[model samples]
Target: MLLNNLTKKFKHWLPLAKSKIEKGASQLENSINNYDPKEIIPSKLIERLNTKLNSLPVYESYYDTLTINVHDYIHQWIINKEQNRKNCLVIKGNCVDNLYNILTSIFSEKSSLSKETIELDYQIFSLENLKQNRRDRLNYLQEKILEIQQQSDKKIILIPDLSYYFSRTIEGLEVLEKLLKLLDEDENKFWIIGCNHWLWLFLVKIYHWDAYIENARDLPLLSQENLQDILLPVLDLVEFDWNDLRRFLVELPNQNEDDHKIISQLQAKYFENLANLSQGCLGTASQLCFYSLRYVKNEETELSNLKINNPQLPDFPSITQSDRYLLFCIGLHGHLNKSDLANILGDDQIYITSQIECLVNLNLIHFLDHQNIAINPLFYSKLTKDLKDNHFLVESD
Candidate 1:
């Protein structure tokens, strides 16, 4: 009886299995017959398309977007400073992108001034140079500024990253104070200082450095429209899969006038979400763009799934109080070498090496060069918030 039951089950399954195989073969035959040469897209072209989709869109500067107000504000500041005979104008922002945008606009060719007038008689002092005696570094910088003042009627001094030189030690603060004093005394020279936001806040609280500058401005957060303006130009570079875009638009109640217009609107919303996710930081937004598109190894699918979502914040591993302090110091300076970090931490190199390796492996921090290491920019905003919430850094208004 058991053998007969087994035989009955096999007989029932056999016909069903055969039917499925026959249907599959018929479909495969139809697919081959219907295949057209035009349907076959070159793999190279597909690869290029995926590359464009994965990459961050380039913008000349923050000015390219609708966020031109910051640019205009700086231009007006320059005009006012020149008219009032003000010597120093400080442009401070938490976002590195904003600070760079302001600096580039000042030096951009769009200026109406003559080539000679627009020329920047500027000198940049790197933090690496300050490894010498602090007193000597201060004196050398002062001497350079004075010499530049004498050479040209308009002297423009630029400190690309001022936070790099700031130190928790008394001597470091003194060097910064002396340098600022010297810059203040020179009424004929124009000083354009770019500082990271965290450092600027710390300076105001600890050193009262704000009193030395004639005027200071913070870059504003970009709006959604502003972000759209910045990203739209780059989207024009590639021909996206319209079928995919159309799938997203299937829910529209009415068929729009032209498919192109409807598709363009949907694309704008995609960019809008990207802008929101990045929280209006151009640098962060650019990095997120790169993270969203991923390549898959499935040969069956032409293009891998493009993930358009906010990147997940890195999960930091267990760290000691000392590790936290070191991270804050690096975040404050924007970047620092092992020697400088060790100096600030008042700890031995061996003590922190393992911790550094752990953080690097977790992608919380990375080496900017052979000697210098800095927090990853993608994690910067989240790290700052974490530090603030944990009462690591003093809260700033």
Candidate 2:
């Protein structure tokens, strides 16, 4: 009877023992990515954080906005907008260059017509300057820019994104070659052309593309102060508890007196580390900032409903080998639609479509539109490292 009772207890406890072992193993894996999450943060927290970020007016898409006395990344061009001569600019992409933000900068200059000019041209070229579109905006922009060009001794011609002109396909090669011919021959116009750094490298390898447009300047890497300035608009709009970043409350028995001083120091350190981790990419740093934000929803005290989740580098473990190469290709091109990806990989378009859909669901990739997909900025750094580890060629982040 006693033996029977012991067997029953053992049977009851076995499943619990097994579950604990499995849970421990799961935690071990998480530790490799980030400190074994001290708590299981519900997915809703991130959703809520995103909602709060979107609610802010100035927190527009990835371009650092026109707040804090800032224009877009085109500061030099803005300063020298009137140098009326046959000068040209080639903006080599550093991070995912959002051409729309470039338009916004021109808008900020009170040259709304100039913004329209760029918008129209981009529409004519293709979706994001890559696909086929039958919009009249293209014609309107071309006419407007030319009109402006004829009026001023020197007006700017901005090709916001060169990536839009071609894809990783046979026709794309012909299109880019033609574009090179245009750049070489159009010596009478003041022009500024932008291309993704990865895509630029690929073009250089294939067609010696840079030979046509010499001396492309890279977008500068932002420093801590620069990142802070970029996000100043969000900082004002978003509510975060400065107190949460304070360290060692237990160690500081008389902490109240030094609270302000400590918090100020921590705030500076926060952005400094953020700049380092994001490698000075404004878009990447912005996402990391959002990821670190949490809403406590408290209704008491000055900052009752806020906290800082210490920022950590995203270390996704579930990314597979195929995912790595697909991401590399996207990085190489700056963006790719399903069909574009299919053509490059020589895989069935249907299969390519499903794979990208799965990646989007997993949040490893995001859509620029209904068709074009790009790597999520948050994952770019890790993807770069993973590619290097696998002995794949990767450009600088």
Candidate 3:
């Protein structure tokens, strides 16, 4: 397929895009020119707001809202714009209070209007808060939706926590379904749920079809196809260079050695695939591969197998889950025991333990006689060699 065809399709909408751009530009200039810091309603703040608003995607069918700063004044500014229009809604405040306020706001609005705003405080899902009680959150969300529907004929609903909700816990998944259920069934009521990257992944994992709905405006029938078209290209844009992969692995929270090893191996396989497929694409291919790698939850062992069978040495430093595991195993004094591994890693034990056992089965690590806990002398020797060679271990005696 010709790539330029896609560009042409985008170009077809240039006139509409131009007008939006001009309006954004005008807003930005006015905000910037009138800049002042002394007042609470300073132009400096508006300038910043304009900067963010200007960067919003020009695609007309989808309504875009900056999910930043749920600060009370900032949310009021958004709601104030909707007060002039009958169709928009704003839902805002602390999570529980936001739910209560959203209910009151929806009830207080004129039901005769074709549309109304429901601005939410979106912050109620702070990691600490959401993990506290999934059931309560889900119940509150369900009630909040009904409360809003009782008040207005709002078709399009904008929820900024799509990203936050999804990533914080599985509870967000319930929130997503409730939000969709709450929306009017009509074509005009497009639900724009803005979520961050990890939450986006959670959405992708559970409701792959819904991601398409997020962008669906025209024909409901082509939601999947349209979503695929939008996602693949955007996914193609997301990638991580080898160097970036290394840095990310290093910084992962409570990162374990086994995780490092696995991630490292996955990164290698991904780049290897990139080398074969990404001839003219360069960084773009690598970036897309990075996104794909992050979602390797489905075929992790297959990826690990790929790394072992066809090792792809990254040009720069990188760690994989396998690398981490290997390091952790290396930390053992004697031959590493499978039973010891199962006891320590507990809930987190990679489901691919059997496959890893295959490595031991292949004589990579020797099992002690009559005891399943011993590491092979040869394997430990190899680990020592690798650590010394890679400077992971310092020479002693």
lDDT by residue for model 2 over 1-397, one digit each (tens)? 9999789767745644554455456556655775423344355655564455444543233233222112222344445444322245566654354643453344333333334234322211223442233122333334444554345333445666665544565555655565565445543444566677767767766677655655466666678877675555566655667667655233433456576677666667788888999887766787788777655554455333546765667656465566667877777766776766777776667545545655665567897667778888887777666767775653433
| Candidate models: Cα lDDT each | 0.57, 0.57, 0.36
lDDT of 3 by residue, 1-397 (tens): 5789667656644533554455456546755875433222333433443344224331211211212222232334345433322222332211111122223233323241122234331222222344223345455566656665665432334453432222123454566566655442332333333332222333445466333342311101112222233223433333433333444343443345576675555445434444443331222232233223332212545431100111122222122334435443324322234443444344223432443444443334444334434333223334434555665453222
Residue-level error in angstroms, candidate 1, position 7? 79
**Shift in Å, residue 396, candidate 1:** 5.4
Q: Kindly state the number of residue pairs that clash in model 1.
A: 0
- Candidate 3's displacement at residue 119, Å, is 14
Name the top TM-score candidate. 1
Q: Which pairs in model 1 have colliding backbones? A: none
Better of 1 and 3 by TM-score: 1
Give per-residue CA lDDT, model 1, range 106-196, as digits (tens). Answer: 4433352334435644444544556533345445555664666466455555665566455666667766776776666654466657787
Where is the poorest 10-residue window by lDDT in model 2?
65-74
Against the true structure, candidate 3 has what lDDT?
0.36
Q: What's the count of clashing pairs in each model shown?
A: 0, 2, 49
